[model samples]
Target: MEIKVIAFDADDTLWVNEPYFQNTEKKFCSLLEEFLPQHALSRELLKIEIENLPLYGYGIKGYILSMIEAALKVTDNNLTNEAIEKIIGYGKELLNEPIELLDNVEEVLQALQGPYRIVVATKGDLLDQERKLKKSGLSRYFHHIEIMSEKGEDDYLKLIKHLDILPNEFMMIGNSLKSDVIPVLNIGGHAIHVPYHTTWAHEQVEAKLDHENFRHVEHLKEVLGLMPV
Candidate 1:
């Protein structure tokens, strides 16, 4: 079947997202090491953040706050006004960093724009995604941009229904195996997995090699070669 709608995953799929988090985590981890053992502190922070996912969702701002709260809780230290100020300063730095779009993302999207219906179906902070989209200068190619809090079976199902597109006629292209591939395949849609070099810890999932509807590619630009139009 000919593909009609081409959906994409934002964040690390098209740009540098997790790296920024990694950088922030490195800074946080260094400070944290002063109060707690590095390994213990890292594990505890992960536990706290994961536990708070329902409340915090995902983003730099929420993550920074969680780190601060975790430090206070784990050390039993009353967070000093000075330390709070440092955290706030780091948060501002994180927010101000420039968005980095991956190589060939703009070129590939622009090439495929006229022939197919392009859409960005990303899962992340609304403000962050919006900022990246606006700054990337590739937003014009997409007819639809969806900034979702989460990517699951229901989310994909709802998008399919809203777009009024058949499962067979749609393609979900993304770097995630769990969020992007499985959900699309579960809904009877075609999905292409472009394995990114670096994936967020939360977004990582075991790769399924035997899936019939799922295809893998080395790069985002490779999608154009697979399609007729």
Candidate 2:
């Protein structure tokens, strides 16, 4: 395998992300508990968030709006302005959360830096993703940073073209099988799945993949061993 470029997913792959979003979700549920049970509110919020994805894309800003919409829906459009403000505040706090690098992230990047063209290929709001990358302190190790709105097969194909590499010459590493692994494999590229303790429900896939271009590792450091020597 002649892998020239190695792209890493940002959220939950390079750093702590989903848990912080989950924490904010709990807070959101509590704020609207009077209108519905915690479980009900969580379901409503997830429904609204999924619906809003096309319009708002992925990020805390979209999440804030979705939470407000959920609160309004659950409250029969009788929620107060104060409740809306609190939801916005929750999102702001989430956006301000510190970047916590995942285990062995830096060590692995340092090991592969000179040998491969390392880059970040992630999906999220452009500003938010850029800010997180700047805060991560791992940006210097990346040769390029592509903040995508989606990670579909076509999107990755474009990225591969822009990187001046064929699909077979590219490799993607991330936690999401839906976004990171399947699409890359479908495009005839290599993918490595480094499972995180928590993953967003939308990114979850139940299928067991068996592909020559795919590798699932329990830890990020194991990627070093998979590289062609």
Candidate 3:
């Protein structure tokens, strides 16, 4: 309730992100359908992504690399040049994808800008996050931007420290519970979950969450109701 600085997660929180990746995955499966079953190839790609997270981090480049690696593995070191081109093109296309702001994202940011210092605490490749922010035209709404390598309790803690605010004075709004909600609550901060339709497997949590500092809403516009107008 004492929240002062409100931090938001980038990706699905502010825009259409995961669905693009999901669609790309579908295309990837189709491209490789000749070599393996669609279900089997999907499973293999997921495994490769999980394994490469630490090595490649998170971004279209890493994702495409994983796809390429998965392709090579599934084909037993036999991958066609055309297939490789298609896979690489997928990544390039994603990188250039237009920034589609979620409904009411700009409106909410405008409403909260004066009363609170808004921040973006998102994890992904630094350059890509920056590029999207530039394209989004929402950069003017934020006081600070924290592109993190990962989002965990420690990362959130560091963010609050940088903002010179105590844990209870901070609130995080995002679409991922595992990345944005649980960690902030664990650190004694408020978290508001605005669920997106699609989530990456690595970001899913089985347990339902309930806590004093936690809140959930069906849309980004609902955030306006939670903040002082």
Candidate 4:
């Protein structure tokens, strides 16, 4: 079947998203360790964050504040109104910073735009994804930009239905084995997996492929070469 819609995952697939989060996390973890070693603050905060996923979703802004709150609770650290305000200010600054895109990502997308109906199917904090998409200036390349809270077989099914495209005619391209590749394959869509050198722990999964429509590659740019467009 001739492919009609080509959907790409936004985070690690198109650019350097996980690294920014990792850097922020390391800084926050260090701060917690230095100030509140007695309570094992970082671990506790991570647990809280995980428990709050349904409530807060994913994003650096929420994460920063959550860390701060957890630190205050565990260490008996009386964060004054001024200190808390300052931390919020820092989080805002972090949000303003430009997300670094991977090399040739925009170029490759531009190259592929002429022939395929390009769409960005990313799962994350909606606000953060919006911020990153706008900042990257590549939003125009996509026919539709979907910011999903989660990715699974059902998500893929719903997306295909909404787009009015058959599973055999859609291709999902992404970096993670779990979110990007397996689920799409299970739903009978073609999946092109371009492995990133570094993957977030949560996004990583076993490199297992049992679907006939699945394809794996080493680089992002090579995807354009494989498809008709």
Best by lDDT: 2
Question: Candidate 2: minimum summed lDDT over ten consecutive residues — where?
Answer: 220-229
The digit string of per-residue lDDT tens for model 1 on 1-229 reads: 5678889888778888777777776776777676777677777778887787788777776787788888797668776777777877777788888978887898788877888889999876789778888888888989898888778889888887878888877889988898888888888888999887887766777765677777899988887788775
State which candidate, 1 or 3, has the greater lDDT: 3
How well does model 2 score by local distance difference test? 0.93
Q: What is the lDDT, from 0 to 100, of the residue 224 in candidate 2?
A: 91
Clashes per prediction?
A: 0, 0, 0, 0
Q: Model 3, range 1-229, lDDT digits (tens) per residue?
A: 7879999999999988999998899999999898999899999999999999999898888999999999999999899999999999999989998999999998899999999999999988888999999999999999999998888899889899999999999999999999999989999999999999999989999868879898999999998888776
1 or 4, greater by TM-score: 1
User: What is the C-alpha local distance difference test score of candidate 4?
Assistant: 0.79
TM-score of each model, in listed order: 0.94, 0.98, 0.98, 0.87
Clashing pairs in 4: none
lDDT score of residue 45 within candidate 2? 83
Candidate 1, poorest ten consecutive residues by summed lDDT: 200-209
lDDT of 4 by residue, 1-229 (tens): 4688999999788878766665665655555565666336546777777776787776776676686777677658876666566556556766777778887898789888999889999887788888889888998999988888788899888888889989988999999888888888888889999887787666767776766788888888888778866
Quick one: RMSD of model 4?
2.6
What are the RMSDs of all candidates, in order?
1.5, 0.8, 0.9, 2.6
TM-score order of candidates, top first:
2, 3, 1, 4
